[model samples]
Target: MTDRRVQKTKKAIREAYLSLILEKETPKITITEIAQRADIDRKTFYLHYDSIEDIIHEFGRQETEALILHLEQNDFFDDTADMAALFRALNALIEANLELYQHIARTPSYAFLWGQIKDILKVSLTETMGERLDIPRAQLEICAEFYASGTISTYLAWLRGDLPMSDDQLAEIVGDIAYYGLHKLISPPKAEGDEG
Candidate 1:
């Protein structure tokens, strides 16, 4: 286990970096700025991280691990997983980290972070769903990638105000799409003589 003081220092660094990212693009952020904001000297900052990108990468790694752990604890990979409940749990996790997610969503430079997270989820989903489903591994992987990418992209859109829906509503819609596909959401064409 890491020492408490080390953990504290790392937390400070991460918080400082996140705050800086919110103000400007990642490339414009400097180690000096992070050290100053974190109230630590340059040497101390180097002790904890190599650069701003390191902090960002660490944040992505930590959040991805947290997501996987959360899903596992919630039985998200179980054979009888409850799609609705799983999505609700996912939304709750996202809500809990709304600021971080919002930062990632609005910052174009952080797009790769989101992509990395989504790819990890796709792999996990592909492995588990493959074992459960009788379909070929390649097809299952494609399907998992589709669902994982679509769900995360939709959540990002919601975060950016493009969806303008509540967490519960988003979760419900995502769950529906996962279980029933787009056909469930689309209405059949109206007859020519149909009236409102």
Candidate 2:
């Protein structure tokens, strides 16, 4: 009975947090507002979180985890895949919690949220590139950092209105770059011996 009550109380708190965010910017909302919305007192709120920021982090963490799982559910890790769907996964995340993220991105906890994103991408990339990439330790770390930053930065660009492209289009474009690599940037000199 105690466990069930705790679960119910936590659920109420989470749902109330979402409610408040959807209703207004996260800043305008306060612990009092959330506690009231949860139909609980300030004591209960404190029992669950050290601060409002802690609850906010919990919310973003849940969102990032859900995005990762949804990607796995759709078999986004299929062998020979280009990992384009990962971008789509990100898009789905933004769309799923559009209001919340829009607000959180403006908060001081934005860096923590980004850290979660990087961790998720690191796990997924390692799974996808396993064995196929016998990269050196240095190169492996560099590859993960480059592609993870590229993905996040590209998504941020889309969010900030750099491109009018939809999530799918953005995903395809980014995926192509990942799959084709920077080789296309080089020019080939035509030679007599090069003719097949």
Candidate 3:
């Protein structure tokens, strides 16, 4: 376990970095600025992190871990997994960290952060779903990537206010898409010649 003081210092550094990133581009933010904002000297900052990017990478790692943990705790990978419940849980997790997600959404430079998280989820889903569904690895990988990318993209759109739907509505729509393909979720138009 990490020491409490070390954990506290790291939290301060992360908070300071996040605050600065919100105001300007990551490349423009300096270590000196972070150290000053964090109220720690350059040496102290170095002791905790190598550079500003290190803090960003660490934040991604921590968030990804939390996501995986939340999914597992909610039985997302179980044989009897409930698609609606899983999506609701996922939405709750995102809503809980709205500030961090909003930061990613508003910053074009942080786009990779979302990709990184999605890639991790894809890997996890591919492995677990492959075992559960008894599908080939290659097929499972493609399916997992498709689902993960689609779900994350939808959530990002919702976060950007482009979707204009409530959280529960968004979750239900996404859940339907995941549980049933577009063709199944939406009915096809009947031919003009067809009569009832």
Q: Which scores greater on TM-score, model 2 or model 3?
A: 3
TM-score of 2: 0.80
- TM-score of every candidate: 0.88, 0.80, 0.87
Off by over 4 Å in 3: 190-196
Give the per-residue lDDT digits (tens) of candidate 3, residues 22-141: 788788899999999999999999999987888988988887787778777877777425566656766777788787777687777777888887887687668667777877778888
Residue 16 miss distance in model 2 (angstroms)? 2.8
- Candidate 1 positional error at 132, Å: 2.2
Model 1 off-target regions past 4 Å? 187-196
Worst 10 residues of 2 by lDDT: 100-109
When superposed on Cα atoms, how far off is each prediction in RMSD?
2.9, 3.7, 2.5
- Give lDDT tens digits, candidate 1, residues 63-143: 788777877787777743556665676677678778778778987888888888788768777877777789987899889
Q: What's the residue-level lDDT of 194 in candidate 2?
A: 86
Which regions in candidate 2 have their CA more than 4 angstroms from the true location?
Answer: 1-4, 19-28, 106-108, 182-196
lDDT of each: 0.82, 0.76, 0.82
Candidate 3: how large is its RMSD? 2.5
